[model samples]
Target: MTPSTENRPQMSVEDFEELERHASETVRLEFINGRVQAKPVTDGNHDQIIAWLQRLCMQHRPELWLYGDRGMKVERYRRGRARPDGVLAPFGFPAGHGDWSEAAGVLMAVEVTSHDSDTHQRDRVEKPDAHAAAGIPVYLLIDRDDRSVVVFNQPEDGRYRHEEKLPFGAPVKLPEPVSITLDTEPLKEFAD
Candidate 1:
């Protein structure tokens, strides 16, 4: 079961950043809703899904880059720090930025659902809220659990004003700013 905010470890943003700096490479931590949570290590299928999207983005939007596991400062007033599975941004957007870069120019934040108890809360709920709160243009969720693709966009009042869910093998248009159509048929092979 996912822990409640009061039950999770609480820390200031500064403290969380310090802890993240000292964390080993294998451990990835996120500060969300004023609590510290460890992100699950991704599986091979997860990595493959990211790779597939990465290649697709590069081929279609050469001017943009899909960065894997890039740290981003999100949420209202940028209080939250998250490392999304894939961050789509203008080429070289993260240059000279610190560990957690502001989400200013981020076109999309992608998350592939991991097989874990907290997947529903973390990926489907909190992440979309955080990204939308940061005014990110799009939030793409490749949900393995449901074998579907969820596209979230049009941020307003700390939430996405629009959401579209399509089953695997369906065609998905990532919408503008992102403006890339995805042939999700390949995603079927990566489903767990």
Candidate 2:
């Protein structure tokens, strides 16, 4: 038999949590509002940039913390959840629940874009707001298709006051005292 084309109804946060509690797969999943969605599959190009950025942040190992493709629920005024491609916290959170809201207060969150329409929207809109509302200082968006990195800072009124995009090899200076380089070429291979 061939695959069915029917679409399932979106799930709620509780349902999402229950699913998480019982899941066995490794694919990334995220929830926004009440809709749970799967993160876009990472191509080699995506991994290259993620590895590059992570290595760039290696100097902060002692007090600095890094979480790759982890779920973080931003607790601003409301409770919103997101699993950013990566996260940085100068100091990781104390022993608490295993979720993002519990593991740490984010200094920065990174989202690596892919080909799905839903994936792109969740990364661009819902996740950014969640990070900002949670008082995260920076949000970096890596758009694989365009080979660019968008840096967001100075959260005000549920959105970042500063938004800047840099091309490949452009210097990205984060508040965490590190100079990272973002290259666009590596991602071009995964655009397929």
Per-model CA lDDT versus the true structure: 0.94, 0.67
- CA deviation > 4 Å runs, candidate 2: 1-12, 60-62, 91-95, 176-192
lDDT of 2 by residue, 82-105 (tens): 677788765545335465454245
TM-score of every prediction relative to native: 0.95, 0.77
TM-score of 2: 0.77
Q: Would you list the clashing residue pairs of candidate 1?
A: none
Give the count of colliding residue pairs in each prediction.
0, 0
Per-residue C-alpha lDDT of model 1 across residues 81-155, encoded as one tens digit per residue: 999999999999999997989998999999999998988999999999999999999999999999999999999
Top candidate by lDDT: 1
Residue ranges of candidate 1 with Cα displaced over 4 Å: 1-9
| Error at 186, model 2, angstroms | 6.5
